[model samples]
Target chain A: MKAEVVVIGSGISGLTAAALLAKKGKRVVILEQNRRPGGALKRFTRRGIPFDIGFHYSGGMGKGEILRALWKYIGVWPRLAVLPFPEEGNENLRIMDSGKVVRAFFSYDRLEDELQRVFPGEKQGIYAYLNKIREISNTIPFFNLDLPLTPYLHDLFSPKGMSLAQLLMSLIRDTDLHAVLSTPVFLYGVPPREVNLTIHASVAHPLYSGVYAIDGGGQAIVDAFLATLAEAGVDILTGQKVESVLIRGNQVAGVKTSEKEIYASHVIYTGHPTSLLDLVPGEIFRKAFCNRMRNLINTDSMFIVFGAIDDPDTLGDLTWINYYNIRTGLDIMDLDLRHPEKSIMINAPGRRDSDSTGASGGVLLIRMSVWDEVARFDQGVREKRSAAYRKWKAESADKMIEQAGRLWGDAYSRIEPLAIGTPLTFRDKLGLPMGATYGVRHSMNQFSPGVRTRLPGLWLSGQGTLMAGIMGASLAGMVTVGEIEGLEPLWYEVRQCR
Target chain B: MISDEQVYQQVTQIMAEEFELEPESLQPDATLYEDLGLDSLDAVDMVVALEKAFGMKMTDEEAVRSVRTLADLFDLVCRLKNRQVTKE
Candidate 1:
């Protein structure tokens, strides 16, 4: 089979690129290893209860916002049913800091008011802290679109150039206030010490605008994108794993999948960039690039516990807003991989329809787990592990439940079959290398070339290449296709979309 | 006024690309819709491509509507370029 472009991985990045290219009259074929599409946006049902794997919630879906504009350009906006988080009360975040949990509201005045009550003496410092992030978020070229791209590159070196930790220290003297403002780092999967201030601000600023959950869950967004792809006549092949990228001389000739050899001039690999070396021509990819992809240190993986509550009111002090039950003095930079009670994120997911069992469901994400802990279980092989692995999985689920009970002051009443996702699960299921969340951590000090590669037609897209999350993946898709098509016209087109 | 020779070269190349046409098939008097199968989507995409290529906004609705044939498009582009030059 032959196509103009063969895109591997049916994640948001690959799907978006395929859709846009098809619209431009390119015959595109999308290959996904899993039976379903929507990579991170993929959601599955367990005992008739739907649980989202990567998608929890999103920011910037409000009218005329950057995320909204992007979705509109992708043709998924009109059908998307988005609901905002609490307008008051829990605000957006309840960050657990050292010796105390910091409460922050979405409103600037309210957040400032809450912080001022805690640190009355540091009023101006809080104001400066909030203003700086807002400035950094607004200045990003991708968000504004109309702004020239050159200024964004200079941001890492300009006055804004500094690790989030340094900036927070230089501005806010109080450690408690430092912890509160930098809580968004948890979402970025990076500690303040390593995260660039620019990246931290982009992830945080959207929170203040408002965080939103889709009415029908992430499945709705996936369906909408699928509909768009179908209408554009893009061929989507599922359960087809691309074995290797066929390269002749210096350019990508096609891809050999489990099913057949699909020929294409251009192959866009949206899977883990580190895994690309095994697939592509090594000589053409060069030594330095391959070495970097090989030697790159991935961020820590997560241990998630999906549990069901019989009633919503039964969830004491747990509003729809997510909470970070952080144990203060614990260095986020170096988390104790096991014993998740050290630093755990209790995500208060949106209420889904109770199954026949009649119970609401929520997730508890402990971002501490490491791959080495689970590597002992026969590698690359899943579900066929010994009784010891199964026993370990059960004990870990109970441990998370015990942690949650300590926080909520009540043993989970009528807990559902606790579904636990570990690093091994990420590696075996999601195709992440070390089950690394956000593959290849991007820092301001390092240079990660996005989309473009040394190979003529083989390109890279997805969260690993650029930023992480839905917006990052979507924008990465836009940038990759923009490179193929003219960036100027398409970039401006997205700007004028709303 | 911009030279007709310069306008023809630019117009032919731009139209050939935007409409996905062979340069040999493009005639001065050929209608965009009839000759190139240009539809509504093509018009919007063509307008964006032209605006980016010239680095000028296609703000005048009357000028956009007036162009029918390839020759009309060439004249329209020449007028717009001349207007920009006069303004500068």
Candidate 2:
């Protein structure tokens, strides 16, 4: 089959690129290796019950934000049911050890006011510190304008540029407050010290401002993309994996799969270019370009646990992001996600979803960062690794349940039917490099390759291409679309959508 | 209208409610996670309730590790009250 464009991988990036390119009037074909689309965002049923795989909670859905803007432009905004996150300082964090428990709440103003109250001596300093964070976060690219470069440079000069842990340490001399402020970094699936301020600011601000989750599972988001794609006249093929990017006379000729070869004048790769790097003959790519691609770091992998409890409505709320500092240690990245220091965070969607069937009860979504080998656990001894991973998830679940029990007591027992996946699942299923959830880490000085590759008509997209999560992928998609179809037209389309 | 005992009792009640424990079970020596089994999220929720109940602000540092026992939290209530007293 011949097409004007072929998009490999139907993940968020692939879908976004395909939909936008097709909107530009290009005949597009999308190839997904999975029988079901949505990649990590895909959902599966447990005993006829539907559960979202990687699509959990997100922030920045406020009016006119990047996420809201992208979804509205793509026409997916109408389909989602937006639920407000717990107000700042209303977020619940429960820490349990043995039989003892500690609870914490976070609201930005409340957090600031509380800090002043605690350290009356540093009242002015505390407000100044918090206000600085608020101000800097507001100035970030996605928050205000599309000047990704502005936030990037601001973070480079700011305290956050050093490292989240170091920045917090300098701001708050108090150890406990440092822990409190730094605890939320768990959501990014990385420890504070390893996470750069640029990445943290990008994630933390929107959340600090507001957070939201898509209604009827995240797959509806995929459905929305499909809706837009269909309207734009794009052809999508699921369950097809591209074997090679056919090149002729130093250009992308087409893509060859096992069953057939599809021709396209322009090829936009949503999957890892490294996956096809081996497939592309050496003579085609400039040595320098190949070197740059080879050196780019793939993000880390993660473990996800999703379940339906007997009383889902009674569990963690939609915006309930929790963290447990199992041990008093400075080495955040070294902490194993599979075996933790006794702290775990879990969220239940039933509490805040006033629109749910109530019978849908509570939806338990648990996430953790794991080693990348998780995706390759099925080949020979690798199969044995699956058992280890299942055990790890069970242990993690028990820890989560224990923490929840402290907060919800007997109500926690109602949680049941948990499904688990490790980084291996992401690697094998979604074609991620290391089962990494956030693409490559967006560090202070880390130079991310633009969507366009040296190979003409070949471009990159997705979290790995930019960063991870929905907003990042959408922005990456927009940039890729602009590059291919011309930025002015892309912006014009955006204006029209508005 | 709120007495010291009332504030103390309410603080204890927040712990009990958040941890799903009885007020009597929450002793001053009870460590949050080790004895009462509360995770970090519960700590955050407890702090929020405390803020509303006492009308006194609590910092993230104080909330994260300060309230280890029933007495530790009771003392926080006292501090919050002290602020009201000083203000008055």
TM-score of chain B of each: 0.88, 0.79
TM-score of each: 0.80, 0.73
Lowest-sum lDDT 10-residue window in model 1 chain A? A151-160
Q: How many residue pairs clash in each candidate?
A: 1, 60
Residue B31, candidate 2: C-alpha displacement in angstroms: 67
Q: Candidate 1 has which clashing residue pairs, if any?
A: A98-A328
Per-candidate DockQ values are 0.01, 0.01
DockQ of 2: 0.01
lDDT of 2 by residue, A10-109 (tens): 8888888887777667899988777887877776776555666666667778776777776677776786777665554244443233322223444466
Q: Which structure among the candidates has the greatest lDDT? A: 1
Top candidate, metric TM-score? 1
Task: Please identify model 1 stretches exceeding 4 Å from their true place.
Answer: A89-99, A150-160, A316-319, A337-340, A350-358, A411-414, B1-88
Error of 2 at B49 (Å): 54
TM-score of structure candidate 2:
0.73
Candidate 1 - CAPRI tier?
A: incorrect
